[model samples]
Target: MKISAIHLYAIHLPLHVPFVVSYHSYDYMPSVIVKVETDEGIVGYGEAVADEHVTGESWEGVYQILKNTLAPVVMGKNPMEIEKLHDHMNKTIYGAPTAKAAIDIACFDIMGKKLQQPVYQLIGGRYHDEFPITHVLSIAEPEEMAVEAAAMVEQGYCSFKMKVGTNVSLDVKRIQAVRSKVGEEIAIRVDVNQGWKNSATALTALKQLQDCNLDWVEQPVVADDIDGMVEIKAKSVFPLMIDEGLKGPREMLEIIQKRAADKVNIKLMKCGGIYPAVKLAHQAELAGLECQIGSMVESSIGSAAGFHVAFSKKAITSVELTGPLKFSKDVGNLHYDVPFIRLTDKPGLGVDVNDEMMRELTVFHESVYLKEENV
Candidate 1:
């Protein structure tokens, strides 16, 4: 079926607690949701979250590009032609992956619905019925972080992702405290979020953290420092994971060729959407590099899209799709059993959106019909 109309909504969902990464802090998650309408009366949904520091995009920017630039390109086109639509969108604009991802995800939802299949099946079928999900501990005082880790452990979480990089000594204390509180059984991974200004500082921190038995260290240095990534990877015992540095297959290839990292964190927002994220997973698989599916603190919609990719690819050994858990509420229904997450058998994303709730959360709205000259 041909795409007939497109609708956009800019929403701000309050976080249960403040989410602090090295680059920014958020008490609320700003996201742009897209609804794609087809001639056959089928409708599909998608969501995009833009972090100016991470994806070089803001929610406002994503909304504008999806409405004024990208929508016209996909108007009246087949939603199932995701690859071709991506080609057209790339030619139309550069580096608006977050905006493009919204459309791409919506199209995948449409395809899954039309075929009466789950999105994971559409990708490559599910390799995992339920995979372990990590509970993310935002940057906080060492004791507070440790308490949170202990609480999650009591609730059945076996893994934790700790946000770090603001202060080396404080960070070391944070991990050590959490490890001490949770004991040696829980797996702990740290994401620096490019907070370590350079390789030397990162290496120093990694040195102190070496005895903690970290599952992996993510983005210890800046995004573009391929040489720094290699240096840190070679010097540190912790497995290095590249996050912000990887956006597409080209960067993945570079990371592979240079042996820059032991793992790659694939976020649908960063890599565009499932269409390209699947490609990233395949490339990582072939290169013998493991993958971790990360998140942008998204709602169930965006989180589910990432979950499908993670479930389909065996190379994706680690998952941090805990965005929905951080939010008080979300548009879509994604069930969480602490360390494990599950989606329904419903077609498309399997996670259903709460339209009434979305309306309450919307800050900006727009709709583009095929008859409009904007197309």
Candidate 2:
């Protein structure tokens, strides 16, 4: 089947609470939803979450790329030729991995539907039916964070990722309080989001945090500071996982060559989509580094794509597909059971967009395709 049309929706899904990291804070998720229609009447859905600080992409930019550049390239092409489409986009457009990711996921969804197989099986088959999820604690006061951590633990979440690196001492206190409240058995991780200005400060804070038994510390220094990560890794007791520094396979290779990090956080938007993400995970695995499949503040559509990649790969040691859990509402009906996100045997992503919910959240809409006469 060939492509018929592509639709774009710019949506703002309100969050249950303001999500704060070291560098950015948001009360709602700005996302671009992509729907690809084939001539055979199969439709595929995908999402691209806009995070200027992370992926350097915005919802408006993603929408425009999908309309002007991507639509023309794939108008009469086969959705199953994902690689060729990716190459065409790479050569045609300069930047906008998130935009490319949206189309990539939609194409994968179409391919899965055509085969009547789940995306996980199409990618690598299911290694584990369910994987443990890490609950993220947004930046807040020490006491407030502690309360939230305890509440999440009570809700059946065993792993937690705390947004730290704003203030070293206060962050220490935050971790301490959460640890005290949740007891010692729960797993806790920290993401600095490049908050520490230098390796010395990061090392000092990590040294102070040695007693917390953190699962790992992520992106302690600036994104470009590979040397800082190497130094910090040598000095700190905990494993260091790089997030912002990783773009794709080349960056992964550089990190591995430098021996800068023990682990890496792989996000679909950051790496483009599942195709590149799977390659990055394989590279990390070969280099003896662990990987955590993470996500942007996205809707269930983007989260489902991340979930499929995580479920298909054996190298993914941790998962953070908690977007649906953190959002006030999602555009799709998804199953969430605390630490696990269940996937179905249905074709494609196995999730459908909630039409009413999309109508409620949509802020902008656009569609692009060649007319029958033009084609």
Candidate 3:
């Protein structure tokens, strides 16, 4: 089928509670939604996170790129030629990677619907039916975090991912407090979110944390500091998980060759989408480096997509698609695997977005972006 028209808009889905991380606090997720209309009148939806801090992309910028640059190139082209369309869009701007990413995912979803197969089929053909325990806890005091940790254990969450990066000493104290309370049976992991003080401070913290049995420490330094990460990985006994520093499989390869990071975190937003995510997972498997499939505070739509990626590979060690729990209400009717994250058997990502809920809950809204079809 050929493309008919493209519509780009912003959907502001409110979170049930404020999502606090090391760098920012978010009470609602402001995502740029791309709805592509094909000549057959089939509509496919995709979401791109408007993360100014992580991707340097805003909702307006992502929406404009999808409407003006990407929409024009894809029109009239065969909808099945996703790669050619991806290349055409990529050539327009080497800069707007994240914006390109949102549009790319929508196109793939459209293609999947046309084929009557799930997106996972095109993304390495579903390896596991379900993923392991994926959970996100609030950033509380050492005592409070420990209490939450104990509660999570009771709830059947095996892996506990903590948000750190406040300071070297305090971050250490927080991990230790959880370890003391949980008594080391539960797997403890920390994500600093690019809050590293320096190589020296990271090394100091690593030396003290060797006994904490951390699953991995994420983005101990900035995304740009590849050499610093390599040096830190060399001295530390625990694995160094790279998040912000990576772009895709190619970047992951570079880090592996340089030993810059012992592991890598693959979030759909950062890697563009499942097409590249599967490629990265298979490549990581070939290289023997573990992969961590995480999230960027995505809604059920984005979280379900991440779950499919996690279930696609055995190389994935820990899963973190906990965006649904952070929200007061899930805007979609998707069911994830209990105690872990898993999408239903329903088809094509297997989630239903609630229209009425979105109508009243939408905290932000924007006009439908349209481009000249003949342009």
Against the reference, the lDDT scores of all candidates come to: 0.90, 0.87, 0.74
Error of 1 at 198 (Å): 1.0
Model 1 stretches with alpha carbons more than 4 Å out: 372-375
lDDT of 2 by residue, 92-126 (tens): 88768898889889988898999999999988899
**For residues 1-375, what per-residue lDDT tens digits would candidate 1 score against the true structure?**
789999999999888999988888898999999999999988899999998988789888899999999998899999998889999999999989899899999999999999999999998998977888888999999999999999999989899999998989999999999999999989999999999978999989988887799988999888988889999988988889999999998899999999999999999999899999999999999999999898988898998899889888889887888888888878888888766887667889987889999999999899988975533
- Best candidate (score: lDDT): 1
Worst 10-residue lDDT window for candidate 2 reads 333-342
**TM-score to true structure, per model:** 0.98, 0.97, 0.92
- Candidate 2 segments whose C-alpha is farther than 4 A from its true place: none
Question: Could you tell me the C-alpha RMSD of candidate 1 in Å?
Answer: 1.3
- Cα RMSD of all models vs. native, in order, equals 1.3, 1.2, 2.3
lDDT of 2: 0.87
